[model samples]
Target: MAKEQHKTNAMRTLDATGARYEARFFDCPEALSGVEVARRLGIDEDRVFKTLVTEGRSGAHYVFMIPVACELDLKKAAAAAGEKAVAMVRSRDLLPLTGYVHGGCSPIGMKRLFPTAIDETCDLHERIAFSGGRIGCQIEMAPDDLARVIPLSRADLIVL
Candidate 1:
């Protein structure tokens, strides 16, 4: 599959940050999981990250990133975000706020700015992978950029 772009928050955000990256697209099968995404991109499965939407206290939405191999602990995530608890936000709710579909959502240039968290597990890879405003399309960037550049909250989210 070839990369496709029709203008998205992710592209705008990348341009704004001056992060040099090339967009690559894969088959985007029904199972568009991060693990398959990494393999399609010829990278380690752990190097690929996934964006997730969660509801905090009072129905406030939050963004979080974690590796395909690890799981996001709602308990720890709530503590990290200073919320009572967190649960997966419905895909229906994500499109309205982020202006992107579920699999395509990216942390960069979200429609709104909420407290964002990237699992410390991301540091395990020198170059991390994330969705590029589309299910198949992805961008590769330095892990440090997600921290120093993006300035997102970081936590050791993986139980392992």
Candidate 2:
């Protein structure tokens, strides 16, 4: 089971946005991705977002929101966050920093306000879905609206 905090990143995100959303669960593999989620929910791959935490040489951590089908361009991510280089953080560095596990990380409610990045690809749609601080659940809302709600570094972070 995940945390028992009762409040999760998804809940905080929705609350911050004042957006209505629901949670849907499934018997998922430990490592669930947006691709699998889109299939299960019968939604487009572009509509399912993935939450990832990254870091730079400076040891600054960042939370990035992007679609599974799309890749996070390091250069673009750096540019968006006004940094020089951005890369995936080590597994050991993730849990303590984000206060969440890597597999079920969310872009909201972290212990600290790490920089956040949302792929501009999501802007094409009115609503998009992302992990709900758990393995098998997701939350959906308007992309632009979501950006405004969460503290995010908004830009084109997708290379594909």
Candidate 3:
């Protein structure tokens, strides 16, 4: 018998929006680095994106998605969000702010829809993968499909 698929808020949000996506699950009881996740799933690290939450100087939160292997450039992120500066939100504050734990954060279905940006590199891929609002699951879909569900701006968010 096949394992039952776990439904997540992110998945449900996509479903409500009529977005097409594929869910990939793995045995990850503990948090793993993004590169490790890509390796375990046999996906190119560049095709696996990480969702990052940051607070602008004005105290507004913002979301950014970038390739797992790359580092988010704070200056660029701030620029994209139209803030004087931005800093990553505290790990402990993540759950209360976004309704997600540190490693399982997803761009979709957050506690609130904050201003969001996707790394320009995403345009190079036909599909990208991100957390499915849980530790062991990932959602894969075309970038355009994701944008249709969540408003997203394209920016150069990663370190070169």
Best by TM-score: 3
Q: Worst lDDT window (10 residues) for model 2? A: 1-10
Q: Which stretches of model 1 miss by more than 4 angstroms?
A: 1-7, 29-31
Point out the worst 10-residue segment of candidate 1 by lDDT: 1-10
Order by TM-score, highest first = 3, 1, 2
Q: After superposition, how far is residue 54 of candidate 2 from its true place, in Å?
A: 1.0
The prediction achieving the highest lDDT against the true structure is 3
* Alpha-carbon TM-score of each model against the true structure: 0.88, 0.85, 0.97
Q: 26-97, model 2: which lDDT tens digit per residue? A: 677686667977898888998788887888768787778888888888888888877889889887877788
Give RMSD (Å) of candidate 1 vs. truth: 2.6
lDDT of 1 at 138: 85
Q: The CA-based lDDT of model 3 is what?
A: 0.93
Which wins on TM-score, candidate 1 or candidate 3? Answer: 3
Candidate 3 lDDT tens digits, 1-160: 1134688889989888888999888999888999999999999999999999999999999999999999999999999999999999999999999999988999999999999999999999999999999898899999999999999999999988
How many steric overlaps does candidate 3 have? 0
Each candidate: what lDDT? 0.78, 0.75, 0.93
lDDT for position 52 in model 2? 79
